[model samples]
Target: MATDAAQPSLLLPEAGGGLLAALDIGGTKIAGALVDGGGTVRRRARRPTPAGGDTAVLGAALDVLTELTTHQEWRSVAALGIGSAGPVDIAAGTVSPVNIPAWRGFPIVERVRAHPAVAGLPVVLCGDAVAMTAAEHWIGAARGYRNALCMVVSTGVGAGLVLDNAVRSGPTGNAGHLGHITVDLLGEPCVCGSRGCVEQLASGTSITRHAVAQGWQPDEGPADAAAVAVSARRGHPVALAAFDSAARALAAGIAAVATLVEIEVAVIGGGVAEAADVLFPPLRDHLAGYATLPFAAGVRVERAALRGDAGLVGAAAIAGAATAGAR
Candidate 1:
């Protein structure tokens, strides 16, 4: 477990009083945090997800909660929130993440609510992308945007939306699944049973695969997206082309969202966005071509202000909202 007492705080004047307990569950890690109304992380814990059966995954999540329960501030927690990798059914209180195959339609909400430490506290569940959107809208780059698209472009592409100044989670909590949107009429197939999906072209995994296929080799490390970014920085043509291809696909998808919702901005985050120098320039160039409509032409692209703590902060934001609605 790791704790950061000096973590910078986000100003949320309307956050009200009390603390929110948050859990961010993904393929790699299961993290928990006690966040104050002002968006400051007061306490935190994490556990690496084990590659085992369903019980093992649930056990790891419970362990994180147990660690958090030891904190003195746990007593003041007003609600508990969970943000898990999709596809989650908020109405059903279940999650079916692709990476965690052992947990199809897992009853996460009931299990978490059953915890002794969480006794009687309201619990909220949402897809990880939706949580990221909430975090961005609450205190990150989308703070003042009435309509925006926030994306995570890591191993895969995931996204959520902020519409009319509020996170729109739609039915089932997996509203903004931009990755599965077909961008190319004849592109690669996606694991989501779709052909020519944006994720097949724009994800970090796709970027690395494309760079490697184009004969771009790393100097002294794995042939991943970061290595490709490094090579692009050194003027490697193949690496640059790889990033440009990804940028183009992302541009297509972003333009589609802008056209459909008339979003004013698109806030991008995740591992791929870290290579901003190589990605953004080409992305902006391509976006200008696709988003040619009068309203869509004004769409702005910005990097997400929040990073590692986005999930926890976002979970807290939704939990806070749920708490307020219940009263």
Candidate 2:
């Protein structure tokens, strides 16, 4: 890795070319990075995710990456890695992101390849959850764990599984979508057409919806569930109840996964988990009630170490890992 201090850009060393270029396109943001072999992002840029049909979203992502690649220092990057909302078609280099409806069945790899800077470089696409897990394994919270689950409990719930020290991407590269697991047969309807799914009952959106229905009003805009966490911090009964409801549902989901996989740890992240102190205690207690076995009882639940940058860093890890494996 070489740094150009004057330019605030990174130059990844290639056998003959340069550094690695990574892109992370999520439902909320698009971030690009230049990473070294050790997974440190030498250069980074981010922009809010644009909402629209597929073309508009792809254009937004391209605009962000194009701006990042404009820095002369990133011109010679060797590869590009993409981490996006899944059910991605890894074999076909396409994706049908759950959050971005327009991207359904879009040829993402080809679209990214069209970018001038990354045109010929090897590009690897992966589910965002899997990418997040890879980032944690590469340099974040789950580094020491051979079997861990990294999950996001934000606008929507999603997860990636790492088993036996390996990131798991089952057929179609869309494994470990834990949020869809049904915890309550009669629970709320999910966007995925499932009822009582973990995401339906425990996601940030669900929490806020639950609170608003209980007569809680957020002082800030949008009545975001994040604000409900703020209200809970002030001991608002409505907000606390909202969180408790989410926790109970999430705990059931966790216990079910632990029962099936015997995962060693659960690394939780996303906007909702910011209130870890308020949320985790109840979640742990609920989980205790759900799990009957020792393994499930010992399954430690922790926080995701990486913030928003986890996706980009994870993309870099995937690119670097794939490059190494190929060699």
Candidate 3:
């Protein structure tokens, strides 16, 4: 396992040699950035993710990276960090993202290291959730919290843990996969081979699906989470119920995390979180009912502070930490 001499900043002691090249890979898009110790993106690029096949997926990521290298600041890059959709095995540096079907146990680290422009740079790989945790701990909402759960509830659910002031990825770099944790023992079967996982209820895609199935029609149109949120705001019964149910499921998962790991806070982000008025109230309500133990009762829930760049920032944080530790 890799370790960093983490402080509030979570950067190396020297802190001046170079920037970090960070990649955030997901089903919809591949993003790359040049970031520094201060969580600033000096250069950035993005491309549509080609979920068609293994080569297309990797090529999209490479396209972003190649464009990033063209930036004059590329010379200052110290190391590379990838926060990917996973099932990532840090021990093996392989990834099998459920969303990216073509890449099963893909050897990402070796492939990235083989890239000509980045040949000698160290590559650190972790789940997107783990990277999100690192970002929150270093420069966002969870920065001052000694123990917290950082989650991204978007098209799918992703999360990570910060324990005793350090980002923890567990053995497989998939520790805080709150999405897959079973909330309903016998509810709908999920893509992760589980029944009633938090993702099955709380993710934006799931929320929209549930809303549509419940006959929540958007006069504006049927689209996605945004449509659901708009309908929920209008007090549509089915849409409201959909949000409430998802909130409850998320609360169950969050409570489980708090009860089991004893976190002081839960930091939430992503598309689903945008419906804060609809989501947070019921989330806290259900959370109260579930997190009954004195130890877990006081866990605070808050929105993410990093906004759109959390994943990229988190990736950069991991890269900064790993390269610093190596030095």
Candidate 4:
């Protein structure tokens, strides 16, 4: 595991009081952080996720929590918040992330609460995409927006919505699952049993897959999305086409969200968003074509201000909200 501390910032001023213990659990890593009310990360720990059974995954998360307890500021933690890859049932306090197959309806909240150090503290849970949305609304690109869509386009695509100035996670904590929305009516089927879902075309994994299928070879390094991005920057037709395809799908999905809910802006993040030069120009162009309605036409797409720290900060924001509600 690795640990670090961050400099203080004046973000999330309303998040004053005690600190919040936050956990961001994903296929790649299990991260924990102690965040102050002002959204500054006081201390953090991270560990690679084990590719094992349910017990192993739980153990990894528990280990992150154990390390967090060793911090001097742990005593100031008011509540524990968790953001996990989903589909999660916030009401049931369970999670079933697609990538972590061993955990179907895993009792995440119960297990976290069972931790001795977590005793008596309020526990909050939400989908990772929703957590990102919370962070954006609190201090990132969507800070002042009353309505917005926040997305993460990594190995997979995920999204969350903010409506009327609040995160709208919906009943199953999966409201803004824009990836599963069909963009190509007769396109290839998705793992979610849907045809032409945005994730199948817009995710980093998909971008690489599309590029490779189109005969785009990398100059060096592994043939991943980053490599494809390099090729796109070099003006490779196949690589450029792959990114344009992803941007088109993303534009379709974003436009759908805007048309349906009238979101003022779309804040996009995750690994794929790093290819801003290749992704944004095409995305903007495609969005203009799809979002033709007067209200939807004003929707702006912006890169997420908070990068990697969005998950931890967002989890802390959820914890802060839970603590405030309890008070």
Candidate 5:
């Protein structure tokens, strides 16, 4: 977790002078930003996550947060919000991300509250997928929808639900965690101690593992999902098969979600989603077969609109919700 002084940027008002501090904490990176009311990102900083140490990782996150304070607009910041990799406990203000094993049940809310520069403001927490759902529902692809499911298909599959016109992050902040849902109840063992979960078949990590195990190799670097995507585009049989399997699994999971929540849209984003040309067609085709029920057939699948900014925008939205609740 090595960091140098950050170059700060100043953000004036886009719509209003109301500003918020936002943080997006994942297993591999921590990003912080100052966002105004209009979804404008005024300033941002990122720090690489350190491996295997809770204190060091928290220090890296704090470094990113401290960088946000260097902005000229810091004085007007009204609240703070964090979208963290979970399972997060909103009531306990703690998180225990499987990727960040050292932080079992870590009390993140209390620690952020103690940071002198940003303390005293209301701090909010939500799972990363729920945060993304909030951002999309607020201004991105899900804006006009009354119900939706938004997903991130990166190192693992994660998703959240918007039901009855609000993000349903449920108690303990782990609701709408679509990855661990058993799509193939008798298929393969999942790391979440479940069998045939969508994450076991459809995540970027799983895709990469399947490709390599089937003898798909890049000419150089380790064959990740991105590499597999490239090979699939080149018409490699094994690569294409991997994507087909993953896409089908993803479709099954989406169909299940639609059946349960009655969502109108399914928005997807993340590194793995960058391979849509290889994944989307098969996903749509498979979805038609799985979503046989009348209520679920109309669910429209879509690509995420905000891309990299979604996480920060979503974090700000969480804080904005808190600010409104306090009124």
Candidate 6:
């Protein structure tokens, strides 16, 4: 268990250095950043994700913290926040990520708090989408909007909802798993044991699958979405079609969410979002077809302005806000 000072200060406030350490745990990488109270990243580091086991992942996180705090200028970290892949048990400080089997039932919060460098710091946990949404609200695309949705499209699709100036973390902190939504009852299987999920049809992985099915052979055989995007730009018909499939699938998910929540804007992020023109135009067109209701119409679809660090920054925001609330 974390020490008293490290506990969430929901009732009592403490005045001290407000440096916050934020970590974003992804399937392929573990990214960390040291953020000041004002939400500026002071230092950043990353490591290829460890596939061996959860312990190895924790080791990598500790190694990152050691590197960041060892630098003389960053010793005043006041809290730690982790924005991790869901579904996470925020109250329990545990994670059972659907994609990372090794993380099932892992006590991530305790493991992180046990680190010597940050043992006495308040710690908060949130799903990646929610954290990213918080980051966007703080300094990214949703900067001025109190009601918005931040969605990420990469290896998989996920989202975070913000309404009335607060992130809706929902019960168990897995509120925004848009990727798992069923887009096609006959689609491919997802890592979550679901068939025909939005991720199965629209994720980068799906783009690769569609391209392969179209008989577009890559130099090394089956290629990922990024490779397909490059091929599409270079006049590969199959690749272009794959992009269209992904856009349509994603648009379906976005339309569903937009119609349900009526958010003011939906900020899309993640690796695949880099193919902005190839992806967004199709998404907008597809969405326009389905957004017939007045409430859902006029919902803007924009790119996430936080770049790749949105998760980390959002984690810091969660921790900072939680700590302040505890105060």
Best by lDDT: 4
Candidate order by lDDT, decreasing, is: 4, 1, 3, 5, 6, 2
In terms of TM-score, which candidate is strongest?
3
Lowest summed lDDT across 10 adjacent residues in model 1 is found at 1-10
TM-score of each: 0.91, 0.92, 0.94, 0.92, 0.92, 0.91
Candidates' C-alpha lDDT:
0.86, 0.80, 0.86, 0.88, 0.83, 0.80
How well does candidate 5 match the true structure in TM-score terms?
Answer: 0.92
128: Cα error in model 5, Å: 0.6
- Per-residue lDDT for 2-107 in model 6, tens only? 1122222211122466577888887777888988766678899888778888788888877877788787656667678898888899999998766567889899
Residue 38 lDDT in model 2? Answer: 59
Candidate 4 weakest lDDT stretch, 10 residues: 1-10
Which candidate, 4 or 5, has the higher lDDT?
4
187-287: candidate 5 lDDT, tens digit per residue: 88776778998889998989998998999998667779999999999999999999999999999999999888788889998888899899999999999
**Which residue ranges in model 5 land beyond 4 Å of their true spot?**
1-16
Q: Per model, how many backbone clashes are there?
A: 0, 2, 0, 1, 0, 5
lDDT of 2 by residue, 1-327 (tens): 111212111123444546677887777777888876656678888777778788888888888788778888676677788988777888999887666677878998998888887766889898888888888766677776777788888777888988777788887887789888999998767778789988888888889999999999988777887799899999999999999989998889888888888887888888888989778988988988997798777778888899666777777777766765665
**Which residue pairs in model 5 clash with each other?**
none
Per-residue C-alpha lDDT of model 4 across residues 241-260, encoded as one tens digit per residue: 99999999999999999899
* Model 4 ranges with Cα > 4 A deviation: 1-17
How far is 252's C-alpha from truth in model 4 (Å)? 0.4
Cα deviation of 97, candidate 3, in Å? 1.3
Backbone collision tally, model 3: 0
Model 3, range 64-167, lDDT digits (tens) per residue? 99999998888888888999988899889899886788999999888888889998888999899888888878878887788899999887888999888878
Candidate 1, 1-327: lDDT as tens digits? 112223223323244557888999987789999998777788989999889999999999999999999998888788888999888999999998866888999999999988888889989999888888889887788777788899988777889998877788998999998888999988877777778998899988899999988777899878889999999999999999999999999999999999999998888888888998999999999999999999898788999888868888898878877877777
- For model 1, the stretches where C-alpha displacement exceeds 4 angstroms are 1-17
Better of 2 and 4 by TM-score: 4
